[model samples]
Target: MKQLKSFIKKEFFHIFRDPRTMLILFGIPVVQLLVFGTVIKSEIKDVHIAIYDQSKDETTKEITNKLLSSGYFILDENLNNLDGIDAIFRKGKVREVIVFENNFGQTLGKEGTAKMQLIADASDPNIAKLAISYTTAIVNDYIRKLYPEMQLPMQITPEVRMYFNEEMKSAYMFVPGVMALILMLISAMMTSISITREKELGTMEILLVSPLRPVQIIVGKVLPYLLLSIANAFIIVLIGHFVFSVPVNGSFILLMLETILFILMALCLGILISTAAKNQMTAMFISMIGLMLPTILLSGFIFPIENMPVVLQYFSHIMPARYFITIVRTIMLKGTGIFFIWKETAVLIAMTLFFIAVSVRKFKIRLE
Candidate 1:
């Protein structure tokens, strides 16, 4: 009994002494709690919307005010004409556009009914559906509150048009996200494990001392995976387009270029991870735990990022998957070209350069 107790105490001391163990035991739980608790929200908030009120009547103004004030939406633009609706949605900032027909207040007063169109950017169907529903509810609430004692039933008929994805296919949303997730995990994990395996097997020192420069060594390790990952991406896209019926409405070349950029960024990130990791297990652990969950959750893969708390939303900015998912969705669903996605493209480029710089520095330090 005494010996067993001593062994248990020694085990506890070892666990407490290892920072990684402590982090796995405690830090992960706390982070998961905070991430899950704050990130998973059924309701959408701060949804950017455009209003094209043709009537410019009192009722149209009132309904617009109600939507903007409900905390569920923010007015991104007061569009001048219906002609720009397509352009606005392609830009990806506005989620829904509310258009009130001519003489909205007058029509409601005379006929006890008015027409309003809720045209949503359904590239992200969930947000579009939620925003449309919320807008409809607010309009209904407005009619009820304004006509409590009226005998004639007043109604605002909302016609919903889900742009980009007319059928609101779930596959349309998840395919791009799944593509991002698969590429990020596979590319990053394989590259990290490959480099770390060299370190663990003591071949990294030989490579370091050999004729190859650090950049060359890194490139040599990453090149095969890069080509393989690009092939994997092509297969995924083909499957998504043919089997799942997800559209590749944009330039296929641009899509491939963006995918390559994202894959390179992910591979560079893996190299950075390898520099810090001493073994395959550690590299795998960091790749899986550090990249996977964030890619799935914070990347707006399943959950909407705007619905999350502001801090979590801001934190998601650093997640490479977030930008890639946006890029993929924009190209696949919206068919928008480089003009629409230049910012996201730039972000991925910057991340790739940053990761390469850091990984090279860290690898040199290890070589020293």
Candidate 2:
């Protein structure tokens, strides 16, 4: 019995000694809990919206104030005309626009009904639906409370228009997100694992000692994967288009260019991961845990980033997938050109250069 007890204590010590083991046992669960708790929210918060109140009447003013005071939405701009509606949405400035028809208050008072249009960017169907629903509810509630004792019940009729995706297909949302995930995992994880395999087999030293420079070695390792990943991306886009009925409304060449940039960035990130990893398993683990979770949770893929906590929302800016998904959704859904997506493209380019620079510096250290 004493020998068995001693063996159990020894096993406990062994488990505690391995940091990876302890992390898997405790750290991961805590992180998952916090991420799931904070990120997975159904309600919208601080959603940016525009308003075109042609009436500028007391009733319209009250309704606008109610929307802003509700804490779910923030006024991004007040549109003077309908021309700016498409421009704002294409620029990705606002999610929804509230357009109150001319003479709204007078019409409501005289005819007991007024027309209001709720135009939402439906590239992300869930958010658009939720925003419209919330807006409609607020308007209806206001009508009931404001005119409860009136002879005729006054109603504000909201005509909802979901831009980009009029039918609100779920595939329009998921295809872009899945594309980002697949490219990130395949490019980053595979590159890291392949490079780590060389170290495991003792071939890395031979290559390092050879006449090949660090930049050359990195490029050689990344090029094959880059080509293959581009092919993979093309296939994913094609399948999304044909099978899922997702559209490519923007410049196809620009979309492909952006896709390649993302793949290259992912490859550089994998090289960075490989620098620290000792073996294929370590590389795979880091890629899955480090890249996958952030892409899924913090990238605004499944959940809206605006709905997350302020800290999490801040952290999300660093997520590469977030930018890529935005670019993809904008090009494919909104049909915007490089002028609209230049910011996201520049961010990916900067990330690629940063990863390559770090990886090269690390390689030089190894060489020395």
Candidate 3:
């Protein structure tokens, strides 16, 4: 007990004594939270829209007024022809083009029907969907008000209540994701680099020549990072709860256990990288480029996997962080238990085992 306590104390000193390390350990979570919360928003606001109103009638004017008043869209251009619609979108400001048929009001009065084409840029599917939905709502509302006596053949009103996230704030989605990412960054990447640093500095040889077993040395080095990552995870969750008013609807204990599982997976990945790399620089490079980029881009962190290209979607299936993020979101936001995320949890366990096996093999080869 005394020896373990002494080792823990020494570990704390090593972490706190280095200002750079201390800053990275403490500062990364806060920075990531702020960046994700404020800067990275999924919701579309004031999306530029072009109107090609050939009718120039009272109905068209009223519809335009309603659309402009909705606040979700901004009328950027009054396009005179179909040729100009493509040019406006190509300029990159307009995301949607609303085209009113030439005889819109006359058709509505005579035929009791009018057609308006809604052209949306589908490059960003989420934003495109939102723009279409908002525009449809605006037009439908106008139609309801204008022709109260008219009844459509099919009338369906969707009452969408987003559970766990009433506001559907992007911050709620990113908070858990950022937590996983930062913990991985600190625990796995930093630990791998730090261990490789000792090896590069020739201190690993001295420690190997000592009575300390390789496993003991590895454990001692990783233990501090593990504890620090747990602390950072707690801090991020607390900040998300207090500062952003993000709720933890599920069991806090379960959330913590799942977070630890993910942290262990990341640490194991770091060990694998460290074993494959010859020096600290190579380890750091592998961690940043190989691990971090995939986590951010391919793990469905910032983009939904359902909408990704088929090849990229397939690529994301193998990323450990993808499962970890899914588990965190399910547990924290959806208030689900082991049953809901068991498959993802199983996947994480499998990845951890795979990484551990590969790392152990590489470490043995190095020893030989």
TM-scores for all predictions:
0.61, 0.61, 0.81
Better of 1 and 3 by TM-score: 3
| Model 1 clashing residue pairs (backbone) | none
Give the clashing pairs for model 2.
none
Q: Report lDDT (CA) for all predictions.
A: 0.83, 0.84, 0.85
User: Which ten residues in a row are the worst by lDDT in model 2?
Assistant: 29-38
Window of ten residues with lowest summed lDDT in model 3: 1-10
Ranking 2 against 3 by lDDT, winner: 3
What is the TM-score (0 to 1) of candidate 2?
0.61
The alpha-carbon lDDT assigned to residue 170 of candidate 2 equals 63
* Residue ranges of candidate 2 with Cα displaced over 4 Å: 1-152
Residue 215 of model 2: what lDDT? 75
What TM-score does model 3 achieve against the real structure?
0.81
Candidate 3 global lDDT: 0.85
Error of 3 at 221 (Å): 1.1
Ranking by lDDT: 3, 2, 1
Could you tell me how far off, in angstroms, the CA of residue 135 lies in candidate 3 after the best superposition?
1.4
